[model samples]
Target chain A: MTSLVADIGGTNTRVALAEGPGLMPDTVRRYRNADHADLTDVLTDYLREAGSPEIAGACAALAGPVRHGRGRLTNLDWTIEEAAIARVSGTPRVKLLNDLAAQGHALDQLAPEALVPVLDGPAQPGATRLVIGIGTGFNAAAVHALPGGLMVGEAEAGQVSLPVADAEALSLAQFLAGADGFAAVEEALSGRGLGRLYDWASAGAGRPGATDARAVMAALDTDPEALRAAETFVRLLGTVAGDLALQHLPYGGIYLIGGMARAVTPHAGPMGFAGTFRRKGRFSALMAEFRVSTVIDDFAALTGCASFLARTE
Target chain B: MTSLVADIGGTNTRVALAEGPGLMPDTVRRYRNADHADLTDVLTDYLREAGSPEIAGACAALAGPVRHGRGRLTNLDWTIEEAAIARVSGTPRVKLLNDLAAQGHALDQLAPEALVPVLDGPAQPGATRLVIGIGTGFNAAAVHALPGGLMVGEAEAGQVSLPVADAEALSLAQFLAGADGFAAVEEALSGRGLGRLYDWASAGAGRPGATDARAVMAALDTDPEALRAAETFVRLLGTVAGDLALQHLPYGGIYLIGGMARAVTPHAGPMGFAGTFRRKGRFSALMAEFRVSTVIDDFAALTGCASFLARTE
Candidate 1:
């Protein structure tokens, strides 16, 4: 039986069909999310172009929080409801999961090449796993092995107060106070966060006008102040991720996805990501047991959507 | 048809027989855990006292981490294995669970009177639940609903980096530089944590003799500085709880269990615990939807151990 899957993102929607488990899509299609009035239009367009195969089950990975069978996209104005989706797609079985949850479902389905090791540790099967996304925004969730299968719990962890350890806390406090006096993890970790960090460092050193993560990266290529800020950002991110790993006891491993993780790969090692991740006092040994990896494939969420549909069916 | 259940703590061991669902304490007995060399001696004593009834299944909840059918008590030097337990109790089936995990299992068995409300929110059945303990030490774990049933993940979150927001960061930075500064969340939130916070605050003010949570609580009864420190501890705890709630999306509810939670209950309402719990930046609405309650019954973990045996059988 064929099943329909869609991963809706801010800029585009990727839709596909799965013939069976681990089956790569015979035909892949993408639609500009803004071009359509709603998700219905996007699905309809995909169906028309793909010869409208009968879907036994349908699942959509949404880029927002899902509650009460509905979701409102964080980056878009679009809202999704189960009934509305079923009506638009003409499918009896429809389910919605957080995009990160879908990514978790796809973890076991990924090829070995899809994962790039960031830290070396044992990956034991049947252990718990943690998935984190740092791009656009910071979010993470824990996935565990349940009695019958696996389950994923989504988290709005980006806004969880960041843990400032040493001199860094003083620097961040001063920087945040200068820029409206309160800064969340997202304010300094996302694409916009990089720019903010750069601006703070530049102004602190009397060199203003630097903006954005890319510009900060450029500045870091030569400027010591920018380098320190970037270093601080990566270290803080690692500490936060380590805390999440401890909270979830993700001995199965930790997977870092999202655009920010990809961009900051170079800085992760130099910024003491490993040291910070394994720095859990007495439980440091347990944290050391957790293997950390970065997901290099951007299409992981799309594949996850397809995989989720296949499993539910 | 009957199974034996035991909840072994550092100080005491409570044992009971499950004639069926609830406890049959007519067939129950209690013993001091320290008096016995191993669990075998305790079981032998209990069985001998209870007329040595044949048991088909056995479950024991230990106040420590369990791995690979073995448990090492955190407070004591006792190490228990399922095989040794089965042999000692003459039971064919034996299962071991973390005391907190067992407490989570017993949630269904808890009567309404067993809980004291801290914050009110909707409780959705089958939603994920988060269990936190703040007593001698701070630890937390999340239970997720899966296809087969519920799975609990163990967390040593007390050792994770502590969340420091605004002035808290400055305090923590200073604390880190002190002799007792490198402490984790447990250092400030547990029974000992309360004492540590008092010590830090007193030292910060150039008066460093406060010791113990009891002393701290007594000083708070009269001294404004002491009260402020206690209030900060509670607020930071609430903030950490809120962080866990957001990370787990614990729609099932947030359960606060431990000696510290009980001790702070009277001061919780007056100290703005509710306000701090719901203070997550953008996810305040989501945080508000979680029901936060403190487990009032001292025997909650014991009851949970009984329930675990009942369900598995």
Candidate 2:
């Protein structure tokens, strides 16, 4: 019995077919999401190219919340439904899970090359694992290892209002608040958020010329305003990540995923990310016990999606 | 086969006998914790009063973190270990769990009368539930409903740095930098936190006369400074609670359990706790979907301990 799996993101749709447990990909395909009207069209194309093999079950990693068998992408205009996809792919049973949840399910299947350890901790088996992604957007989730495998849960923590501790509050109000007022943490911590931070720092430093995140990073090479902005961005990101680690008590350690984490790897050390993460006062000792690492592999989520379909089926 | 269960808090220790699914209070006893040196003393008294019934298994809910089969009370000097308790009680096996974790395991056994709904949501089965406590200390945990019962995991989220949005940050800094220099969120939000808020507000408003949470609440009956401070405390608490709800995605609902929750029930409404909770920008609609409620019963954790021991045995 073969199972078909798909991971749909804002920019691309990844499709693959699995035959059985620990099975190699029979057919792997990718489609530019902009070219397709919806997931059904891309899935249809995958099925046609793969000769429309009979699939016993199907699972998809969607970039949005799954409720009542349907998910609307946060970054894209695509609305994915299990019934619609099942009909298109001719699969009897289908499951839709958040992409991060699928990433969590795939944690156990990662190869040595797939993982890049950021910190080391007590390697106790069956402990809770916290997975965080700092890519196109910022979000995190924790996976508790049950008797058989792992139970993954949702974390929309990125959307929570950013915490401006003491000195940072002054900077945040001066740099973040706009005419309509500052948005949540994601407004300055996400990929798009970096640009906003850059703009705010530039304006605060009396340089009304700075614009996007790229411009800010480039200016950091020379301009103090850009450097200050970048520094704040990295520091706050680290603080929040540490905050999440404490909130979840991720004894299994913390895994940083997505493109932004990779980009911030160099700054993770110098920008005081580690320092801020470990500064939880009395719980600081407990915080030091956790391991923090960044996952630099782009294909990790795809591999995770494949692993998820295999284990559940 | 009967099991013994105990919920040990700073002020009280509740001991009960679980014959099967129900609790035997005639076999149960409550003791003022201050009267006893440690848990063993209380357990011995309870067992002696109950005719020293042979216990098959024993589980205890401690108002502190459980680590390496031992627990240290957060507010007290008491430290207990499973081995010592097992030896004293003649129980072959003993399990110690965080009070919040134990409360989570007892979710299924709770009767309708046991819960008082503060916010309502869809009755979706199999969804994850979040349990939060804001009393002497603050903490949160998520309970994943598994087959036959619930699986609970501990979260030290309370220790996570409090998010000080805009105005709150200024007030917090003013409060912290004053005479005490206290930085903990629990310093201002717990039973003691309200008092600190009042002190800061009074000082900030140039009135050094008002002190204590109760005094501040009374002053708020007429004083604008006291009212604003009280409102800020509730709003900050609500924001943090909402953040936890989002972080856990407690689609099943958010259960507020602890002494502070009860203390602030009346003020929670007027202080914009609900409004701050539901103000998550794009995710506000999703936040509105969660059911929020305060656990009014003092014996909720005790009942939970009883239910947990019964099921495990």
Candidate 3:
């Protein structure tokens, strides 16, 4: 029997039917969450749209913290639970995975072209891999291929205090900390992080700062301050990514996902992302052995849900 | 039949027989590694002394990296493989685990008294756990109790660049970096780390530095600089531990092991380790939810070997 897979995000929810790990792309449909009362309502409408297809199991990737098969959306007022999903989707065996875990499961399923290589390292077939997400927020997950199924490890990595190596970096961290007196990894690596970097760079360089991440990236080729911010952001991202690589040792590869990762991919190679990533003291040599890339697939979480159900079902 | 288990260190190796996860205390014997030619010799001698009891499975914990079921001891000139151990122990099933992974496996088997609670947090049953080793070297492992068995995630975390938050901490990182100009986590967290912190503190106060870590801890009672160093060491350890807790989200508990951990345990509470640990800005509340403790068992690795073989066999 086919399985139902859905990726529920803050603004939109995408649902699809899956035959094992492979999804029926033609059946894929996106619906604004704002139009629905809750996840149950969304799933009900989607099932009706799909002609009430029979399903054996279902899995949903939610943008929130999951505990005991239940998850709550960070930006949406919805408590998504496995029981509710199973009730609506007509399956008892269902799974609710956090967004980052979904990304981790999607690693092996992504097309080769969707993973744009920014740094060189061999991706060992069955080895563990790390998926780092840098969108409106930052988070990470580790994927392990076990005998039973693929196990994705959880992380609130975005909330960890930011790492600063030099005087300039410390100054930037201080600038980011401001009244809070603490700067987390997300404070300098997510979408708004670029704008924060620009603000700090401009403040230091005696220039006007960009209004947002879009404006700063738009001025990358024209404005010197924006260029400096992009370079600094890329290097900081590399350093943080490098530290994570060492912590996880994801021999398969390190997949960078989310809005900020794709936005910075074109300039990462030139801005010395790999250079800063490889600056881990005596472990610098070991750093060169990791493959870092950006995930370009917008529907990765959906694929992840399909893959999750495939392995479990 | 009993299982054979051993923990191989640089200077000493502890060998024992196990009935499932429980180690036979009387069977446990410590051997000076310099006396034995290799692991096979030690195992052979131990078996001879025990009247050659048959072992259905065998597991050994090695103080080095393990790749493809083979391991090389960092401080000893030895190569250990599953097949080699199988031949030596007369068991076809043999597993070689890195020392940190072994510690990760030892978590559940550890005596309640052995785990002295350094910080208060609920240890959720069947949840993920973290084992952080800061002995002569620093390293950590994340333990997941999956369906198949306990899967310990590998880490070369000690080799990562040191993180700094403030001016004083940045100065300490700089001083620790020295000529290498790059200070890793091990540089500021392991056994030698206390000495480096003391050196930095002493040098800052225009006082004499200690000969080693032992001297610094010994001076903690009367010397203000030594106390300062200890305070810094404990606080830094907490910060790193807190960061790791976020990275792994090890709701089960965070177990601290090794010589450094024990030496600093008495001072950890008084020195504000928990205070620094919960300093993760907006996520401080989340940090308070993690249980941090010290694993005091001297033969934890040996117990880990037994536990691993018990689950697999």
Candidate 4:
């Protein structure tokens, strides 16, 4: 049966049609939240443009919490209800999944080329896996293999207090906290967090910060400060990711996703991710059990939604 | 049907009999691990002393990882196998659980007086809960309500890197790291960690350190440095616990267990636990959703085994 799947993030929303467990590549379309008034409008416009093809079921994955058939985007002012989705799709078969959960479910469906290994280890077949996204915001999902289906545990880990061990990192956390006196993990790990790191570097060197995260990443090759900020971001990412690996015990693998992770993946090795990740006091050896990877598939969530619909049905 | 249950730790082993879902308090016996060779001897000794009561099943909970019906004590030289347990209890129905998992299962069975609420909030019944143990070593369990029973996820949380935010705390971590250059959460939050805190305090003030965890806690009333160490321990516990809360998203509550947690529970308020716990930047209000409590029951693991036997039967 033909199904509609949408991956909704804090920044933009991607809509696609799926046949069985496969996402239709050419049918995929992206929509900016700033242009669309609501998810319903985005869905309606997408459906209309695609010759208004009938969809048997619909699944929308959002970058936030989903409870009781509703999804509330964490970094956006959008609340999506299953009923609203049903009305727009002209079908009552609808489901809402946290974006991280979607990514988790799609892990198996992603092509080998879509994933790049950052840290190598044995990936257990059915062991629990973790999906971490660090783009517009940060979050994680623990994928558990259950009796009938997969159970994905959601976490607001990005909102947790920033962990600091190094002196300069501590200063950066303080700089980010400002008067708030509270620097969250998201403050140093997200896309905007990259900008904040760059700003911290500039300020430390007695200069006014002017560039955003995109500009900072683009200037990494030429700009020493940008390279330093990116290096710091990757190093801290390792520390945070290491803590998360312990928290979840996802021995299957740790999959990094979203824009910021991809942007920094190339620099992770040189920036000291492996060193910081495996530096646990007594459990240093245990860290080697978890393999780390970056998921470059943009339509992985769509694949997840399609797979979920097929599995549950 | 009668069942035998044992809660094995690094220091000691607790054996008890359960009739259906109730742990026979009078049948409970404590055995020092040093006195016995392994779990089989302890179980045999316990069964023989308990009048060799015929049991239908047996369950043993260990303070470490359990895999393929085998449990290994993390901080002890002990390995418990299900076959050995069956031979001791003379029952084929035997199961091995991680100590944290046992504690997780016991959360619902704890008596009113056995639990002391530290942070009050609406504990959503049947919602996800967490059990954190800070004793011989640190670990956690996530209690999930499944259709037929509970699914507990084990975590080696104590072995994770110690999170340090305060300047003095960072110094403490560095001190604790010593030449190893890695300070795990267990190194700062466990019973031994308390003693390390005292040692750090003494060294910082140029005083000779002379105390274990028990001696430090005993001197809390008169010794200013002892009091400060205890205070620092509580605050760090809060920070680590808070991180676990976000990692697990336990809306029901965070249950603190083991020796160190109970010892420092009284000073949690004045030591600034709640402040550090709830200081997650923009998610400060969201922190109010998690309730924290200290589990005081010593026989909770026995109850957990009994409950598991009954539920599975």
Q: Whose lDDT is greatest here?
A: 3
TM-score on alpha carbons, each prediction = 0.94, 0.92, 0.96, 0.97
Candidate number with greatest TM-score: 4
Error of 4 at A84 (Å): 0.6
For candidate 3, write residues A1-313 as lDDT tens digits: 6999888888999999988898788888999999999989989998998899998999999888998889998889999999988888888989999988998888778898888998999889888899999987899898898877788888988888788888999999999884547789898998789999999899998876656888989998888888988999999888889889989999999999988899999999899998789887778888877898899988898889888888776
Q: Model 2, A1-313: lDDT tens per residue?
A: 6777888888988888876534345466789999998998998888888888888878888877887889989889988998997898787678888888877877776666766666566745678888887767788888888876678878787787676666654577446544424347777777777777777766776777546666767677888877887888888887788888878788887888876677777777788887778777677778777888777655555566666666666
For lDDT, candidate 1 versus 3, the one ahead is 3
Descending-lDDT candidate ranking: 3, 4, 1, 2
Q: Residue pairs in steric clash, candidate 2?
A: A118-A293, A119-A292, B188-B193, B189-B193
Q: TM-score of each model's B chain?
A: 0.92, 0.90, 0.95, 0.96
| Residue pairs whose backbone atoms clash in candidate 3 | none
Could you tell me the lDDT of residue A82 within candidate 2? 89
lDDT of 4 at B309: 86
DockQ, Cα level, model 1 = 0.49
Which regions of candidate 2 fall more than 4 Å away from where they truly are? A19-27, A51-56, A171-182, A209-219, B25-28, B177-182, B209-229
Q: Which has the higher TM-score value, candidate number 2 or candidate number 4?
A: 4
Instruction: Name the runs in model 3 displaced over 4 angstroms.
Output: A178-180, A208-210, B178-180, B208-210
lDDT of 4: 0.87
Over 4 Å off in model 4, which ranges?
A178-180, B178-180
Which of candidates 1 and 2 reaches a greater lDDT?
1
